[model samples]
Target: MRENPTASADRDTPPTEWSVDVPETAAGDGGSDVRTSNDRLLEQYRRRSRKKSAVIVVIAALLVAVWGYAVVTGPIPVSLSETVSVLSGTDTGTAYQVIWNIRLPRIVAAVGAGAGLAVAGAVLQSVLRNPLASPYTLGISQGAAFGAAFSIVVLGTGTTSGSGPILSVIDPYLTSVSAFTGALTSTTAIYLVAKYKRATPETLILTGIALAALYTAGTTSLEYFATNTELAALVYWKFGDVSGTTWRFNALLWFVVAAVTVYFTRRAWAYTVLNAGDETARSLGVPVERTRLFGMVFASFVTAVVVALFGIIGFVGLVVPHIVRRLIGGEERILIPASTVAGAALLLSADTVARTIISPIVLPVGIVTSFVGVPLFLYLILRGREYW
Candidate 1:
């Protein structure tokens, strides 16, 4: 050992590898702090999401329940069990006939119209980024009114003679066709304006307001020139009604609403991205302008179908979407679907109330929707503009 100095020195030297000995308390505290923070954030998110979902579900359920009660226990006073039995096909009495044949169709129409309008409103608001945007706001309703009026005043008269026999042969289908054409015309005009302006939100809103006013004036002039009977008919049409809609009309409405809903839902995620900003969406590879155009066209189509079927049922499209947005975050994914459910519930309930409140003399469903929807909407607006 004495002869090998280098080996001796190596043996005497301490190990070069280093090791850190952390204090147990310090390590435990840091880990606990990190986990606590994570847990708090996650819990907060869960609470928020749960609250939102719960509110939507509760509101929808309440609406349906109240509507069901109203439908069963009206002036005619069918029992709940009887209503259920009729729906299930176990009962076939006169009561059942009344319920199944008359009330059911009206209910279906109300629900379909409500859902269609609400989704249309949501699409318009998201695309335009304007809370005020709605089916009526864009002149689609007024345009439809003009078309229907034109058919009743111009086409109907031209097609028929003053002779009772000849007038009796005039087809109602012609009026429907005219209304649809007017809706399409308005839609095309709005689309062109939106496109020419690069689909900017402000441009679309301003264009829609101008066109709506124009269409309204045109409809008013048509009404002014209409015969007394024709004016009465036009006036009734403006009030809106689901009472006379047949199953065929309901089926058509459902098909259109379903198709539009599917198309919109498919692009919902992209819509969420678009809401962040056009440049942001473009940067993320979303076709911002194209998506906006598609949304507008699809919404317009839904509005056209609804207006054609039930005349100008106002406020459903404007009110439902804003209410839904307050419950759910502004994400289109949640907003669109929620609006669909919420709108249907609201409209169905309103229709039920309209029919039952006056007993044998049913009020127009549109009147009820506007009466309830306008006050609620005003309250929301007064409370805060940013609620949407």
Candidate 2:
């Protein structure tokens, strides 16, 4: 009877099937959601990269446009069609002479000098980790100035012809050599201090100030004893000009600039990592002291060459990098090249204005830059903490 009851109960309870409902997320939908999120993020990164590339491309285009404008612009008039014709060798007239011999060289010189100095400034700011560091502020230009002044006064390498707003140098080569010598000397001193004495950036900056003062005093002493013509010539040379630059000179300057640009751009990562701090950079296998010293040497070399060839063009090395950094952020890879192009454009624009601003008077390019740079520099200083 018991067996019959148990069997009947089991049969009645029966046939109950157990089932579990799995969530959709547990069915791998969560992984799919994750992949979708990753895809979206990758697309966003690509878009940003494309935008940044486009910006650099746009800046390059603007530089080309400025170059074209500069080529056609001058005391002598040349139309766009004529410029193209001249370039194509189809037209060999007065426009050709002016554009080919006069304006083109000067413009090209401006471009090379601007790019060189600007890139140098960028490197200095990064490696030295000083916002105020530049060829000018660091006394390199002043050192070059003293060299040129000494050449003019002591070495008797300077001579002037043509009076009243006209300047001619009898021996630009000798002057340039002396200027380079002086600049290198200054670089050597700085390097020695940085290497052996282990001077901090602040101390080096003070050294620059002292060197600047010493050089300025030396220049002044030379100027005090100079004849009036020599004085005028010295003043004119210090005014920073690209006028009368030859194709040969431009070739040399451009070659140096291109080499330096390649070097600096390739080392962008080093400079960028250096910005994290010297100790951090050293930890990352970057030679902190060596990088700083060599950077100064190369930067000073470029500055000396530019200054020797074109005179003391302040603010290009000092201001253009700061301006470019503000536009593109401090990523040295992009910053260096952008500063190169922007510097060329800015100096060319300033040179153009200098040519046209006072008409026949033809102000010094340095003066125009100073007029623009001083105000811009002040403004940048006021707001620089945001970027630098």
Candidate 3:
């Protein structure tokens, strides 16, 4: 009798049986095989992610400790123990008052603003897929500046000359409102421009840059025509001081930060899907256009609030996200939260250095952030080019 083809093939291959019931050799088994493969891959990824997260947490803790030390042991030279005691409300003295009341709020402001701007930057960069994208690059900051300048140059001057009570004549609330309005307006314009032919990254970046230039020019013209006292006020505002921020201001800052953080964090999953390309995201049931629009608007609102309070603190949004991306990879789920923490630490350290580098003559927080951010950003660009 002639040997059967299937039996002959099996026997020639190996002594091991190749039955249809064999788990690894079964035909029409692709679904199960794929599931197994995916399960293994996912487990490996989770393990790697856990290790990376631990490392990041340790690094962040160390940085925070260093920043705290710098804040305390500045030009004034307060001990670490004394700083902790003061912060914890167990210390009582003029030194405590100065640190707690004056420096503390400034530090808080820096941390809050830095984190907010950084997250905004990361979101925009991922959504636009453009490295040049940032809060300023997207025209939000310029729009905010215009609103603030308008209020200071026109409304502020008008009220100052005829003021009975400063609060009654012109409220800071109005300035913030104007900034928000301008920010939304600019955001809408950019979105409309970018959405013309399917929302390409290049188109969005170009539109943002064009609108930013226009807003900046408008702000400059306003500054030029401002009255003498208004000019002085506007100059101070433009430098982005964190000094003299009150509890009320801090509360407002906290509220806005919390709102933005919660909103972005919830959308972290959507952002990750979004980074995978619009077509892919849409195929997977993501409303690509809606998600992008919502994220941009929410981020713009945050930027507006920050600029309204602190003036134009540039580069934090641009620099912080790139740094975070390098540290944590391009997954927005990780990038968003990581950027927030890293940005806060960076700004806190910068603020500490700024205040102590010249005691009683503190530099603008904006100046300090840029001083540190620029060199780091340049290094990133060089490294990024090499990587590419």
Identify the superior model by TM-score, candidate 1 or candidate 3: 3
What is candidate 1's lDDT per residue for 340-384, written digit by digit as tens? Answer: 888888888888888878788788888998898788767756874
Off by over 4 Å in 2: 1-46, 156-158, 161-174, 188-206
Q: Give the Å shift of residue 235 in candidate 2.
A: 1.0
TM-score of each: 0.78, 0.83, 0.81
Tens-digit per-residue lDDT, 1-388, candidate 3: 5467766676656657455543342333555875667666777998978866864686579567856665575556677778778878898886697687766777778778888888889888776666767887778888987887787677772233333211111455677777778788788887777677565555776777787888889888987997766666666677766664666667787788778878888888888888678899999898989988998888888888787777778888988887776666777777887888887887777777777788866777888977777787677667665433
Per-residue lDDT of model 2, residues 233-347, tens digit only: 7778788988857777788788878888888888889999998887899999999887887788788878877887677898888799887766667888888888888888888
Q: Which stretches of candidate 1 lie over 4 Å from their true place?
A: 1-51, 151-180, 188-206, 224-228
lDDT measured at residue 166 in model 1 versus the true structure, 0 to 100: 18
- Per-model C-alpha RMSD: 9.8, 11.6, 7.4
For candidate 3, what is the TM-score?
0.81
The number of clashing residue pairs in each candidate reads: 0, 0, 0
Specify the highest-TM-score model's number: 2
Question: What's the lDDT for residue 82 in model 2?
Answer: 93
